[model samples]
Target chain A: MECLEVYAWLQAYLDSGVTAEQERAVEAHIRACPYCRRKLVAMARVVNALERTSDISPRADFTRRLYEALEEEAGHPLAPRPREPRR
Target chain B: MDLRLLERCRQGHLEAFGDLVSRYQSRIHTLAYRMLHSREEAEDVTQETFLNVYRALGTFQGERFSPWIYKIASNLCLDFLRRRRHSTVSLNAPIGPEGDIPREIADETQLPEDVALAGALGLDVQRAIDALPPKYRTVIVLRHIEDLTYEEIAEIMVLPLGTVKTRLFRAREILRVSLARSD
Candidate 1:
C-alpha cells in the first residue's frame, strides 16, 4: 500500500481490525519507511496513553449528593434494597 | 445493570433506586468526567443521567442496563457541551488544523503538579481527549476510556457503524498529529 493509505489505515492496523491484506501492506510500508514507522510509534504511544488514563472519582459524598438531587427531582427518596451477591 | 435492582426501582422503591445509584454512580461519573473535563459538570451530568434513568425505569426493557445508562450520560454530556459553547466566548479560536474538531493538547510543563492524577503522560493524553470535539470525544471516551465496543459506541452515539468507525479513526489520526507535533 502507498504511504498515505498506510497512514489512513494505521489506526485500524494498530487496533488489529484491519483486513489481512491491508495489515501486510502496512507492515511492509512501515518496514521500508522511517516516517510512517515514526507515525506508527507515535500513534501507538497515543493509544497506549489512552489506556493509562486514570479513573476520575466523584466527590466524597457522590452517592449522598446524587440521592439529594434524586430526592429533589423524584420528590421522595427510595430505600436501599438488599443487594444480591455477585457470582 | 442489575435486573433485580431495576425491578425494585421500577416498583417505586427509593432504597432500591439508591442501591442502583450506588452501583452506577462511579462508572457514570467517570464517563462524565472523562467526556466533560470538568469535575463540576461531570458531577452534574452524572446526577442528571441517573435522574433521567430513574425517571425512565419503566420504559427500559434491555437486558443490560449499561448501554441505556451510557446513552443517557453521553447525550447529556453533548447537551452540556452545546450549551457551554453557546454561552461562553471561546478565548482560543481553534487548534486542530486537519479537521474542524477542536483538539486540546496541554503542554506538560504548563500542567500543574496536582492535575497529573494519572501522571504526566496519562494526563497529557487525557488533555488531548479533552480537546477533541464533542462527537469525537464521545467516541474516544466510550471506545477507549470507558472500554466499550465500537458497536456499543455506535449505539450510544446514535450513528451508523461505519460512521462511528470512520470518526474514531479520524479522531485517532488527529490525536496522532497532535502528539507528533508536540514531539
Candidate 2:
C-alpha cells in the first residue's frame, strides 16, 4: 500500500478495529516502512496525551447549583405578553 | 433510585428532576469539560443540558440513559463551538485556574516534583486538543478518550462512517503536527 493509505489505516490499526486480513497488511507495511512507523508513533503520542489530561471534576455543590438554576428558570414567567399597538 | 423517579421527572416533578440532576451532574460536567476545555462553561453547559433534558425527558424512550444524556451534552457542545467559531474566539486558549494541569510523558507514579514538571507538558497537549475544530475534536475525544465506537460517534454526529474516519485521521495529524511544533 502507498504511504497515504497506510497512514489512513494507522488510527484503526492502533484502535485494533481493522479486519484481521487488513491488519496483517498494515502490520506488514509498517514493519517494512520507517516513515509510516514514525507517523503511527506520533499519532499514538497524541492519544496518550489526550488520555492523561487534567481530571477537571465538577464542583461538589453542582447538584445544588443545577437545581437553583432550574428553580430560577421555572419561576420565570413563560411566554411574553403581546404589547398594545402603538398610536 | 428507581426508574420511577425518571418517570416523575418526565411528568414535571421538581424533586424528581433534582434527583436526576444529582445522579448525572458529574458525567454531564465531565463531558462538557472535555468538550469545551473550560470549567465555567462546562458547569453552565451541564446545568443547561440537565434543564433541557428535563424539559424533553418525556420524549426519551430508551431504557439506557447513556446515549440520551450524551446526545444532549454533545448537541450543546456543538452549538457552543459553532457560536464561538462565529465570534472568532479560540476555545483552546487557556483560561481559569491552572491547578489541575495534566501530567506529560513522565511517569505518573513519579515523585510529586516530577509529576509537576510533566503537568506543564500535559496541559499543553490538552490545550492543543482544545484548539482543534469541533468536528475533529469531537471525533478524537469520543473515539479515543471516551472509548465510544466510531459507529456510535457517527450516529451521534449524524455523519457517514467514511466521514467520521476521515475526520479522526486528520484530527490526529493535526495534533501530531501541533505537538511537534511545540517541541
Candidate 3:
C-alpha cells in the first residue's frame, strides 16, 4: 500500500480497528518508510500528551456545591438512596 | 451490572447521588475543561451535568451509565463553546492544502487558573489543542483525553459511526502537522 493509504489507516491502526491484511500492509510499509513512521510517532505523541493527564481534580467543595444545588433545585432534601454492598 | 450507582440515583437517593458525583465528577470536569479550556466553565458544566442527570434520570434506561453521562456532559460543553464563539478569524488557520480545514471562532483567553488546573500538557501542546477547530478538538478530546471508544464518541457527539471515524482521522493528521510545525 502507498504511504497515503497508510495515512488514511493510521488512526484506525492505532485504534486496532484495521483488518489483519490491512494491518500487515501498514506494518510492512512502516518498516520500510521513515516518513510514515515519523507521522505515526507524531500522532502517538499527541495522543500520549492527552492520555498522560488522567488525574484531574475538580474543586475541593465540588460535591458540597452539587448537593446544595440539588437541594435548592428540589426545594427540599431528598433521601439518600441505600446502596448495596459490593460483592 | 455496572450501573448500580445509577440504579440508586434513579430512586432520588441523595447519598447515591453523592456517591455518583464522587465517581464521575473528576471525569466530567476533565472532559469539560478539555473541551472549554476554562476552569470556571468546566466547574459550571460539571455542576449542571449532575443536576441534569438527576432531573432526567427517567430517560436513562441504558445498561451502562458512562456513555449516558458523558453524552450529557459533551452536549453541555458544545453549547458553551457555541455561545463563546465570536466572529474572529481563528489564530490556527490551515497550513496544509485546502478541503478539510476546521474553521473556528477563536477564544484564545486561557486564564492563570485554567493553566494551573491543566493536567500534564505543556503550553505548546495545550496551544495546539486550543488551536484546533471546535469539532476536531471535540473529537480529539473525546477519543484521546476521555479515552472513549469511537462508538461512545459517536453517541456523545450524536454523530454517525463513520463520521466519527472520519473526524478522528482528520483530527489526528491535523494535530500531527500542527504539533510538528510548533516544534
Which candidate wins on TM-score?
3
Tens digits of per-residue lDDT, candidate 2, B1-183, equal 546777876665656655565566665665677777667788888878878876777787767566667777888998987788668744243233631222232322334432432323365565667667677777887776666788888877888999988888877887888787777
Q: Give the CAPRI class of candidate 1.
A: acceptable
Interface RMSD, all models, one decimal each? 4.4, 12.1, 4.6
Q: How much does candidate 2 score in TM-score?
A: 0.76
Model 1: lDDT to the true structure: 0.74
- Candidate 3 deviant stretches above 4 angstroms: A78-87, B86-111
Residue pairs of candidate 2 with colliding backbone atoms: B104-B118
lDDT of 1 by residue, B1-183 (tens): 488878976776667776776677767877887777677898899888987997888888788777889999999998988898789844321345653555452444543423743433455566667677777888888887778887888877789998998888888877887666666
Give the lDDT of residue B74 in candidate 3: 85
Candidate 2 residue runs with Cα over 4 Å from true position? A53-55, A74-87, B1-5, B11-23, B62-64, B88-121
DockQ of predicted model 1: 0.44
Model 2 — interface RMS deviation? 12.1
Estimate the TM-score of every prediction.
0.85, 0.76, 0.86
